[model samples]
Target chain A: MVLLFTAGCRAKVSESPIGPSVQLHAPLGLPPVPIPPDNPPTEATIALGKRLFYDIRLSKDNTLACATCHDPEHDFSDPHPISLGVGGAKGIRNAPTLINVAYQSSQFWDGRATSLEIQAASPIADPLEMNQTHKVSVSKLAKDPVYRKMFTDAFGSKDVTLGRVERSLASFERTILSGDSAFDRFQYGGQPTALTPAQARGLALFINPIKGNCAACHTITPQYALFTDGKFHNIGIGVNDDGTLKDAGRYHETTVKSDTGAFKTPTLRNIANTAPYMHDGSLQTLEQVVSFYAGQGNSNPYIDREIKTIHLDGQERSDLVEFLKSLTGKLPPNLEEEKSHP
Target chain B: MTRFYSRLWLCLPFALVITGCKSSPPPPTAAPAKPAVSYFKVDPATAGSVSGKITFSGRPPARKVIDMSEDPACVAAHKGKAMEESIIVGNKSGLENVFVYIKSGLEGKNFETPTATVVINQGGCQFHPHIIGVQVDQPVEITNSDPVTHNIHPMAEINREWNHSQGPGDPPMHRKFVKQEIMIPVKCNIHSWMHAYIGVLNHPYFTVSKEDGSFTIANLPPGTYTLATWQEKLGTQEQQVTVAPGGQAVINFTYKGRS
Candidate 1:
């Protein structure tokens, strides 16, 4: 039997000598999780990434880590509408939940980064994020013996590079999946008694194309329910009060005429857990979000055709909100605090 | 004469022999023989192959980074972001995914259609084979491997246009193009970055360039044929060439690169 030490705790690795590959417990019917060829998860890489995830040294001031904004207690999201960065600088969009982020096609509200590796580097350099350049961070980490050993163990070299940092962070983020919700139990887990009658009714309304029509974009197949199509849409949220588009969402990247106000559609997986919703965090509660959709969103030229008029009564509105609430899945085990070094 | 008559009487059907007295048969002549029809066959002695490498002359265009933010599932399917395959220039500056085929040769000749189906997989919110070719009336099976739903809409000019959605667990969608549409562009409206082109021809002489920019169209009958190369970014180029029976012809297409 091989003894493995992780997060200052000793564990037994009875299965294999090469260390066990973290088998992600994906929700029933979810497609196999995609792992990048260059960054296939190993115990060493995951352990290194987990340490870096919670390491304050990643930031310039050492006061904030990734967990500062993406607090696991808050479902890997912040309660604030816009998250604060290194110097308490306000961000443009809400700190979206990292839960089940492995399933997203792109990163950020704008969908700028193609991979998690690309996305990982942006926040480290963003003035409003970790506020540390890759060069500075790499240099700072080179002096630490623990990080050097971890890097060498994770990668083949002791040298800390930006690419390695991105890969490790992405590896850690990939493991943060959320599933096994009450909805998952009822829908895919062979547990018919998991969801309440109200949730069952809500599920029906959410999928009915003529009524709720929510599933048109928030797709729900028989086996999996990601509750998001993973495409960007202009839902009239960022349109200014004077009828002009404000944020320009995906248009900033693609410059397409239709994408002028389009922003990526956020997943409704843990909608209840991550509050102050929408890209701009304009809506305060689930009721407001449902009401915004029911009212066919703020009337704008570029609004997605899927967002149409849906007149729901008070009870139906409550039922829909309850269904959204049912999307909260069990978060994975949290990483323990790293012990201080002498 | 006695032996022949006895054998005929014994070999003839009993009912026919009894009814033979009621009807007089016509004078015997050579049995009418069915004329044999000649099917089209490629004479190996007169067959040749066309091989070439697609190279870029100037700087290649930068691939567009596909924004999959619209669907998190798409982003999640890929490790990082996926890029557009429109102008894939390798280290050798060889362009990829160019559809090369015999454009004019064997126009009036009919060829047998392949019974096996061609597959186009939609994985990681992008088309697996960016460029493909199929004989007319041959089925192209499109499968969705990603966890998310993808709506495949092929906008064809000569053939009927089709738009269909396939989920992960659902069976693959099979489609056939009847007419000879040179290149039909397919786009997944659900995932804009997911696009592919299918080249349809009536004959079997067509090939798409691989990552290394090499392509081969084999088993061509000896003829002076107009071969056309079509790339998504760089427009079509046509060349006229003659091949000796059982000979090989080499042809190369160079596209001016765009920065």
Candidate 2:
């Protein structure tokens, strides 16, 4: 029996030794989640990642967790315009929704990180955020017997490293996808009554290049709608009173003058849930965002030329907001937080 | 019999290592390696030429004035004369920036991927030549001459899509498309007004119409070919033309403006 077991273990060493792999449950209307080649998800990895994501031990003071800012009830985003970090330190930008983020070409408003794995490590080390080094964070996890077992089950070893932690966290995030909204059903699922008359009218105006032209950047394709072109643009946002950009945005990453005020076009999948619009999170509501665009986006020298002033009457404005609300979709199941170790 | 059974149990681990641990056959070796093809050379003695003019009929769309007020550098570069290049009509209704190429006829033939790189310069916050063509695997170099930064993004449908930021004084980016994709739309996310198109073909017989709406595809083996002209807004038109040995074929395409 020992020989048989040893033979089995040795035989599967080259294959998936971490048990069976699992597919992400992506709702309809969204494309398949683009998983990294090296970090294929398993049940063990996802469970470990979820525990790590919600654990306050990852922070310096053991007070802040990923879920503290990215609250699950609020569509995996922070309600505050700027997220409060460990020891009450405030972050520079709004906490973007984790829903459908796996589809994004790059991470963050500035797109400084190319992948979720790379983005996962930034907040843990940032002074204003978690304020914890990878070494300390790994040590915290390694000391816990439960975490040691979980890490062993997930990654085939009791030794915990930052790379495995990042891979696991990214794997869990890849599953927090949302899609199959009312707008998606109406547009792709051929459900005529999925949208109200006002929303239908708004959809028409949204696509009309001369009218709303909202789809110019918040794109919708014939097949599926990711609602983002995955490109940065300065739409007159964050312009100060002195006619200069308050936030350099993409410019800081690329050191390009034209990208001075530009920021990534965030996905609009669950736009209603993740409020306080734009990269700065200044706009309080969808109406203000729409109105800002209607006024041709705060006219700075670096503003996108696509932002032409448009006339949206009272009725049109309300309908456009209604259409945006229809974008709120169903969240993935099994997001309930597990009790943390005392 | 007991000795034989003990020996069989010991050999089971090696059998599992041989069969169970083996990888899945390497994906059929990617369509059998493709037969080695020789480079096609144009026989100058029997080579033909296809010269054509792309003309616009009716009223052309008025070029919208580009507002570069936001970027002081772009405004200074164009001297406030920057306009949309979607529709550039020359004298006598000659339509510029139309891509003309042989759509069909030279098949199963391989052409040398041009060693000379096709340059697309970003000057004054706009793509210098709005429309371009290149053979498959031909190098397409993008250079930024503007004082500002420009992110070049190619939204290719059939080919791989890529987006990169290129700042002034940065080295030119070299890229090539392995697949034949027609009219890949390129955009600058930084400057939303900046747009360009690239057409990739397997053969070397392709050219963009000049400012006077003239295009000439020289060095073509004499044969009947289905020629096509593509205008960004006006759509595409196709025509069949037969070229006599060493003869010049004249073909003109007319695109009507939207009524």
Q: What share of the reference contacts survives in each candidate?
A: 0.00, 0.00
lDDT of 2 at B82: 83
**Interface RMSD of each candidate, angstroms, one decimal:** 15.3, 14.6
Write down the lDDT of every candidate, Cα atoms only. 0.75, 0.80
- Give one digit per residue, the lDDT tens place, for model 2 in A144-239: 999989988987877677777887888888888877999989998999899999999989989988878999989899887888999999987766
Question: Could you give candidate 1's per-residue lDDT for residues B126-183 as a string of tens digits?
Answer: 8977887887887677898887655576788998764554555547766788899989
Residue pair clashes in candidate 2: A301-B70
Per-residue error at B58 for model 2, in Å?
A: 51
Q: What's each prediction's TM-score? A: 0.53, 0.55
lDDT of 1 by residue, A241-333 (tens): 334676888989999989888887788888898887888877777876765665456545777888765556545656888898888876667
Give the alpha carbon lDDT tens digit for every residue of B75-162 in model 2: 7766558889998999888999898889999998776555556788999888977887877887777898876556676888998765
Model 2 interface CAPRI class: incorrect
Task: Output the lDDT of residue B87, model 2.
Answer: 83
